[model samples]
Target: MNPFSYHKPTTINEAINLANLTSRFIAGGTNLVDLMKENVVRPKRLIDISGLPLQAIEATANGGLRIGALVSNSELAWHPLIEQGYPLLSQAILAGASAQLRNMATTGGNLLQRTRCQYFYDTGTPCNKREPGSGCPARTGLNRMHAILGASAACVATHPSDMCVALAALEAVIHVQGPRDERQIAFADFHRLPGDAPERDNHLSDDELVVAIELPPPDFAAHCSYLKVRDRASYAFALVSVAAGLKIKGGIIEDARLALGGVAHKPWREATAEQVLKGHAPSEALFTQAARVLLQGARPLSHNGFKVPLAQRAIVRALSEAAFGNTYAGATP
Candidate 1:
């Protein structure tokens, strides 16, 4: 790891003031610490925002939930409000890292976690995300974990956050605080696709800090599911995960929200596909059609073509689980 100065700020303003282009905030040190060790990210300064006051899970006045950035993943998953009102979020969080890592990973840190592409981590290799204009080896190398959607010629990396997939389906809003002022970013617009700029992940500025996450009123609490498929059963990143939310009435779908992970640069959500689910009765045929619509424009890589079909089936299964009132499922092959 690079030798860098460390600062512990007790206040949000202090943390914000300490932020700079060459500095990074460390709340849980779950992901950032690993990146530093791998030499994937070498910051000149480490700002310890763990001491800052940003750890709370409260209900908003508008009947939504406001989650402080520093709220631990385990805490958020098991929080009574989250478990009762947004079980999909809880499920997604639990499906992530191991129990110990979850205890250390924070909401903001999870949001800022880097991709798991091997080429991106191995400093000896060439990865566009690691160094722009440096050739993307994953595009033609062993790339079973690479992207199948929203990929570009410059990069084929996928976002590696299960919580983010659920957040996308929940339509959560990201709250950020920069040196200038605070702003709200819609979840759909927060994470960007890998177009020309593969280095940038989300819309967060260099000097901005994610203070909290805001969730709109819960609508699909009663019918929701988070399904993650991976090579191994435990402690593995997703291959093709789906977060499905459905609101059905009189055996007819009234509303639907579906977001995909492990298949794109961001949490992939096609509003048109979700619209296809509305007003239709939940069935195998309907779900299959919706999955087809969701994977319409998917362009798989050399070794990750399986992800396209896997994602489609996962979406159908996730929606069926949600509509049928099932909760969790195994990561079966």
Candidate 2:
């Protein structure tokens, strides 16, 4: 890895100052360090914000949960309130990385983690995202893990954050400390699409530090779930994943949210699909229609044509199990 200065700030002010001067922020250092070693990202300095008081999970004034950015994946997955109230988030975290990785992956780091695109990782190849106007090798190269939604001609890289997928489904808000002051951005707007600049990943300013994530409390009695399908079970990124929350009463759907991961440049919010479930009874037909709506605009590449059907099935399976507990999840949970 390229040599770089390291600083551990004792206060938020010092942290912000260091962040302003540095190209990188190191929280858990799980993804950052790996990229640094591979020469994919080489920051002149690494500002360690892990020491700051950003590691707390407390109840919001309105009865929701506020999760500090430095909180580890494992801590979040096993937090008493989260496990009981937001099973979808907990389940998504547990399904990601591994037990050891979860212990090291922080909420802020996880959300800001870079994509797993092979061409982007290996800067030797042509990638407009890495080197603008250079050209995209993935367009004609091996790209089984490319994105299906919100992609542009410049790039088609998937956003790889399992927890963020669940957070999107729950309509969580991201809280960050910026140069001006603290700011709260809706989860949907936090992550950006490739558009014309795939290089810019999020709305985070150079001096901003992600503070915490605020999740509105879900009724513990209501059903919710996250389903991830991969080439292998553990320690593998999702080929297609679905996060869903549902409320059903009197044999009619009261509310629902569904977000797709590993298939979109940003968190794929299926608002159209979710609307189909509201005020409707849970049935195979309803689930099928909703799933179809979600995958309507999927544009697949040469090798990844299977992702569309697979993602659609994943959404149907996740919603069906979440809205109505299934034998599979029951046998496991």
Model 2: runs farther than 4 Å from truth? 327-333
Screening candidate 2 with a backbone cut-off below 3 angstroms (N, C-alpha, C), the clashing residue pairs are none
| Quality of model 1 by C-alpha lDDT | 0.92
lDDT of 2 by residue, 1-333 (tens): 888888888888788877754469898889998889889887988888889898999999999999999999999999999988898888889888989999999998999998889998896788777788887777678879888777788898998889989899989999999767999999999999988888888999999989999998675236787888888777888888888888888988988899999998878996888999999998878988999999888888888889998887777788788878861211111
lDDT of 1 by residue, 1-333 (tens): 889999998888888899888999998898888899999999999999988778998899999999999999999999999999999999999998899999999999998898988998999988888899998998888989989888999999999999999999999999999988999999999998989889999899988999999998899999999999999878889999999999989999999999998988899999999999999999989999999999999888789999888898899899999999767744966
Error of 1 at 195 (Å): 0.6
True-vs-predicted CA distance for residue 294, candidate 1, Å: 0.4
- Cα deviation of 166, candidate 2, in Å: 0.1
Give the distance in Å from residue 161's predicted Cα in candidate 2 to where it truly belongs. Answer: 1.0
lDDT of 2 at 267: 81
In angstroms, how far off is 274's CA in candidate 1?
0.4
